[model samples]
Target: MSHLFWLDLQNLKRIQHLFPKPRGVARSDDRKVLSGISHVIRNGLRWRDAPAEYGPHKTLYNRFVRWSRLGVFARIFRELAQPGPDGKTIMIDSTHLKAHRTAASLSKGGLKPRAIGRTKGGLNSKLNTVCDGRGRPLTFFLSAGQMSDAKGALALLGSLPPAKILLGDKGYDADWFREALAERGIAACIPAHRGRRDPASHDPCMYRKRHRVENLFARLKDWRRIATRYDRCGELFLSAICIAATVIFWL
Candidate 1:
């Protein structure tokens, strides 16, 4: 079995203040429970299957659910992904995650927002992300798998940090998107679609750097929970992504 993941002292100190203050009864050790949460998500194990060294599996499940609902993990991710002075060149892309059958049952009644959607590949969710110059994720957005890349781009437009240029693939080659980038004073380096009569020009050298975002996706998907979607609730699933990103890149 793979060893459990533990937060290093330095990283724990950085995010320690973000955890909510305990009231009434003191909760379990923050470090142990968080490590248990990471181990469960990283290994794609059922909560009940979490190793005992971290604590009771119930504590891990409860803490993950409550904190995900509270957006604590999201806040931690955002705090760590803040751009530095040199974060000028950024890239955007989307990847699909296959959703397990367990996630589909929660979509019944149509009450909860399920990011899962049916495509030629069956049930899946799309993860859209914008990363900084060095391929550190800056923001993330989740949508149904069948949603167009442009729609994902639109959802992430306002969340984009200040940058001099944005690099993307042909999927993002839209007039309105380029115009939107122009409005923000950020130049777009997206290649034109194959069918476009008047193909737009882009810098080959700058566009080459677009692979960094692809690398980011590859690294994020290394975590089993992110590579395959098991959570039915979009919020909970996104929180999983945030936590994974925090540990893999930010921490």
Candidate 2:
């Protein structure tokens, strides 16, 4: 078994504040529960494979599912991901995660589709991410892998903090998007798509910074669970991403 990464005392205390104390004897075992959650995300272990030191695998899985629904992980990510001073420049990009065969076995009406779709890479989901200049993930939106980057870019607009410049690839070089950024006093450093006959001019110097978002995606996929989709439900999958992102932010 791969060595699982456990939350340190400082991070555990940070997360413990987000989870309240239970009123009755059904109280949570904080360390064990956190360890179980960390093991799953860090090692990509199936729920049943979780070590007994953490707790009953089923109980841990149930808690994770419940908390995902409550958006606890999302809140924790937001709290810890405070934008740095260098956040004046933000980079946006998208990457795909191949969906495991088991993730496609979702029963009907249980939840909406989990953003998986057929693409050149096979069945995969796309994660559109925004990262700070230092390559720290700020926010991300999920969509089917086949979805257009322009559509994914729409989700990046509202989630980002005020920045002086936004760096992106050719996919984000639409006229309307550039105009929107210009109106907001944010420079668009995206390169034009090849198909455009009259490509708009952009600063070649700043466009080089687009690599940071790509670096963020590479770092995020270091977690095996994030590199391959395992959670059948979209919210649970997103919670997994948020948890991974939170750890990266802390580091």
lDDT of 1 by residue, 152-236 (tens): 9999999989999999999999999999999999999988998899888999998998888999999888889889999888999
Worst 10 residues of 2 by lDDT: 104-113
Q: Which portions of model 1 miss their true places by more than 4 Å? A: 108-112
Query: For model 1, where is the 10-residue window of minimal lDDT?
Result: 104-113
Q: Give model 1's TM-score versus the native structure.
A: 0.97
Q: Judging by lDDT against the true structure, name the best candidate.
A: 1
Cα lDDT of model 2 by residue, 1-251, tens digit? 34655667776887778885576677567777867887788778888998877878988888888889988888888888877887799888899999998887765355466788889889889999888888888887888889999999887787777899888988888998898888888888888888889998889988887777777888889888999998878888999999888887763
For each candidate in turn, the TM-score is: 0.97, 0.93
CA lDDT of every candidate: 0.92, 0.83
The collision pairs in model 2 are none
lDDT of 2: 0.83
Please name the candidate that would achieve the greatest TM-score relative to the true structure.
1
